[model samples]
Target chain A: MDLHLSERHLRFRDELRAWLEKNVVRPWREELRDPTASEDSLIELRRAWQKKLHAGGYLGLDWPKEWGGRGATAVEKSIFEAELVRADAPPILNFLGLSLLGPALIHHGSEEQRRRFIPPMLSADEIWCQGFSEPGAGSDLASLKTAARLEGDEFVVNGQKVWTTYGPWADWIFVLARTDAKNRYGGISFILVELRTPGVTVRPLRQITGESEFGEVFFEDARVPRANLVGQIGEGWKIAMTVLAYERGATALAYSTRYSRDLAALAHACREVGRTGPAVREKLARLVVENEVMRANGVRMLANLADGKIPGPEASMEKLFWSEFDKRFRDTAIDLLGPGGLLLRSCSEARPEVDWAREFLWSRAETIFSGSSEVQRNILAKRALSLPQEG
Target chain B: MRFELSDDQRLLRDSARDFLAAEFPLEETQRVVEHDPRGFDPAAWARLGEMGYLGLTLPAEVGGQQLGAVELAIVLEEMGRACVPGPYLDVALAAALLAAAGGRERLLAEIASGKAIVTIARQDAAFAGEAPCGIETANGKLRGRKYFVPFAAEAQALLVTTPGGVYRTDAPFAVTPLPTLDPTQRFARVDFDHVAERMAAADVVAGLEPLAAAAAAAMLLGVMSRAFEITLDYVKTRQAFGRPIGSFQALQHRLADALLRVESTRSAVYRAAWCLDNADPDAALAAASAKAYAGDAARLVCGESIQMHGGIGFTWELGLHFFLKRAKTLESHYGSTEVQLERALAAAGL
Candidate 1:
């Protein structure tokens, strides 16, 4: 089987690589290492990066061209991401909007909603946070208690959404709120609520990494226009499930690229410290092997996507692999580098190439946030294997 | 880009699977492993050669099909799934080495047509920390011992490795069988003190290492996959606590993790095979990574398969131990996991 990129996709990748090399003035690690960079300033830098990518016509790649997409395929999209990682470019600021909400709206929203939301979302003028997980319902997302009752011209919302990524900085939240309290899955409605709505509140939640990259959103009778509903009522669960699957296509390529960079940095760091013992070397080598295997898996996925195959529920296998490998890689990095590896990026003695301590802590969230490892395993068992569900 | 077998490769795989299931089923393999001195049926090997499997990766000019490594991996993977017993991989690798050396046309044709059996003997000792390849050739005579030579008793000749070159020495040399954990394997320590023709320089078979590792890893991919399927079937039917044990979340999650390992190994094995066939720049590193990862993944999947099967899993009658033993043997040989890790590290320049 051919794994080589087609000439057309190769051209797309080469052009994107050249563009990234020319445009990325400061790599993301350098930005992170900047002692003076605050959270807000970093976000603004990300917003500017998104604007640059949008202008380069690299955003919404794989979406229909009518909505500012590049009319590219998944192969191009995967290459774009891999190039972004290889160049160490800042992540696009509005990923939630671009990856999750944009797909949801494009597929299920009213034409009026798309007209109002799609442009600003692409331009980073309006950032969106997913309002799926809540304090009471996470792995069991359909159990969400968020309620939105339709009034004359608005839906009055009341619920607290926790682990709302980008909640602290986003202008909007696309929520899965219950419209029919009695039906578990069908009763839910997908509603987009403005943070500026009268009773909405956003409070940053301090993560173990000591950053509020995500936060909790409170909806105390927040009045969102009824016109903002994405699709017919009671169709939110179906839309959310479909949107989550969109996030899975060829992501392993991006993860492998990012991890390979860090792994190389870690290896260099080990050499600098003269930790040449066999034990440390073996650990480093194992990480290298695992990372390369991950890359193989990613390449396989990319090729399958290019072959026009839709990934099935076994996509959870990819999620399980990369997320679990992140934990192992980070843990080994810390163990190999010793105490110095635990220093925060801002610390004077910390390694400049990577914030090892922050990464070690952040990797904990990788498996937890995008469907916890346990949840993914359950999905594989029930869907991919067709094993009998718990009695 | 497609990450699947081509139509021809799929046909080869289907034929190999069908052939193995019919000719060398597990029951037959059990008998061979139990009573045969050679550890494999000679008749079955002849059939494999007749099927053009013995020369799968050799050149068409040498009486081979001129298939690529991916196709070889497909056949070996099916061989692994069937738990087919033989020195099939050993003989193919030996023939490849001979073909690479460039002076053995008649012997290569004999190998491709099932008229000869030969395997490379390189290891100087059975355990680690020993100096590799104590064997040396002086003039036309080869001397010294090689450990863990597969099917040395049955091999028509041995491609003996020296510090200076590789020599193809005829059999009737000293050979002692060294039975290990896997009864289906035929390994021996061969003492060489015979007049031997130095076929190629020491580095002539260097490229074969990656091919050997990747092929072994392909077989491991097959072994572990079959084990996973067997375990999945067992969990579905075997009841405990008034319900099917597969319904248990504890078992299901572990099975899910096993599936992840198995699928990841598939990706790594085929990618390595593809890289080698195309002579890609990443070929060495990919093959090493595939071997290292597949070894560990196979051990996990096979062990967990036995664990989930409970009592019957440990029984010899159930035949699960064959897979578990095969996995261990595969892991410890063909550039053992530790050696492959180092190779991967060196290839990556880490």
Candidate 2:
């Protein structure tokens, strides 16, 4: 197999490198690390970076130009992601909506819906959150209990959605609710609802990492118009599947690219701490080797994206790789950091020390999200291997 | 860039698979292991020579096919899958070093053609970047002892490292069985008292260790796939709780973790092979990193295979033990995983 990048791809990479050098705020990372700076300032910095990235035509690189995308190939998009990681750019603020919902909408949304919703998201003028997971429906998403009843032109919704990323900051939330109670999946509908609506309430849920990257959103008879439907009624399940496809494919790769860089830095730190003994060296070598594999696996999966949409089994394979690798890699870092790892993350004085202790805590949830390792495995076994459904 | 195999490489893999399936199945491999001193059938070794795989990496002038590391990896991967017993890894390594050292034209061709067998007499337990001390050259004679020597019972020539340089000896040497944890490959301790034929040009540790590490990693990839395939097959059909146990989430998740390891091993192996073939600046680092990962990769895959197969897999009749033993055996070859990791760290400038 050819491992060398094409001349055109290399050129694209160079151009993107130049753009990153110019647009990324100078000393941004050091400032982000300044423990005195408020988290709100960090959020604002990320938002501004997202705006600049969007203006630079970096977002939606694979989406059709008709939908305000750059019309880049899968490999080109992969290269963009690699460059972003190399440049140490801040995490994009609208990742959930941009990578998952934006693609799903372009695939399933009506022309009216697209025209009304696409530009605001592209500009980050309206942040979005997903309303899918509920108290009852964690992995068995089709069995969700969220219900919507039609009243004239509107659907009155009542449900509680958990793990809604960006919920606190979201201007809007794309909701999944059952329009017909008789069926688990076939009667479901996809609807978009305003987060600031009269009956909607948002509550942040703190994760083990001591930050609420996601939250829970409660809807009590929130009125959303029928026009907000993604497709016809009974299409929510299909639309959700589409969103998840992108989530586990290119989106996962983006996360992995950053994770690997962090891993490299940890390795450097390990070498600095005189931990390069046989056991430690071997552990670091394994991480380096496995990181390469994880990246290669993602690239292979990305190459197989059909019509810019990675299928369920392919995406599941990648999600399984990154989530598991992230956990093991970070834990290894924690062990390597040793006593230095014991410094609590909130202690600003320890920023000069390796910041891996925080990452080690954060990595625990990677396998729990975007489908837990169990769910991803079931998908791989049932769909990819054609195994019988586990009872 | 593509991560898939080239058209020719794919064809080579398919043909190797078919050939191994017909002539060197697991039972045949076990039979050869039990009955042969060389650890492989002489006839099969000749057949490999005829197919040009014995010298797959050598120059065409030396009667080899002159293929690169990817092809070598493809062949070795097939060999590992079938659990083929042989000194093929030794042969390939010796041929590479001899050619690199220069002025061993005749021996190179002989090894490539299967007319001669050569194995290492490692001065240390593994390739530890240092040759043994007290090696002396007196009146053009060499003296030392090499341990854990593979195929010493039948090798026509023994390659040894000394303080002066790498030396080759066709002179008589003593061979004794060194009991090993692996049944697939036999090992011996070869003692040399004034053995002759010093090859002044070769430096054994520098030229051969990297290739050896890369080959070991390639073989690990094979063991991983075979173990994964067997476990997947077993879990799919073996029923528990009135359903195929593969349907169980715990087993599924375990299988998924193993699958990830297998994929990671494949990636590392391929990249290392590519690096070696291209003579990239980072070839040594890639090889060490690959071997280190392969050590874990094989352990994880083979261990998972047994756990997935239930009690029957542990029995000798079942094939899981073969994979586990072979994987364990190869993990310490050339260098242990720990040693390889240290090499990788050193290469990374630690």
Best DockQ among the predictions, by candidate number? 1
TM-score of chain A of each: 0.98, 0.92
- Model 1 accuracy (lDDT, Cα): 0.90
Second chain alone, TM-score for each candidate:
0.98, 0.93
Please, what are the lDDT tens digits per residue for candidate 1 over residues B160-269?
87778888989786988898988888889888899999898888777788999899999999999999998898889888998999999999999999988898899999
Q: Give the TM-score (vs. native) of candidate 2.
A: 0.93
- How well is each residue in A107-127 modelled by candidate 1, as lDDT tens digits? 999888899999999999999
**Residue B272 in model 1: shift from native, Å?**
0.5
Model 2 stretches astray by more than 4 angstroms: A251-260, A267-283, A299-314, B126-134, B200-204, B240-242
Q: Highest lDDT among the candidates is held by which one?
A: 1
- Report how far off residue A287 is in candidate 2 (Å): 3.1
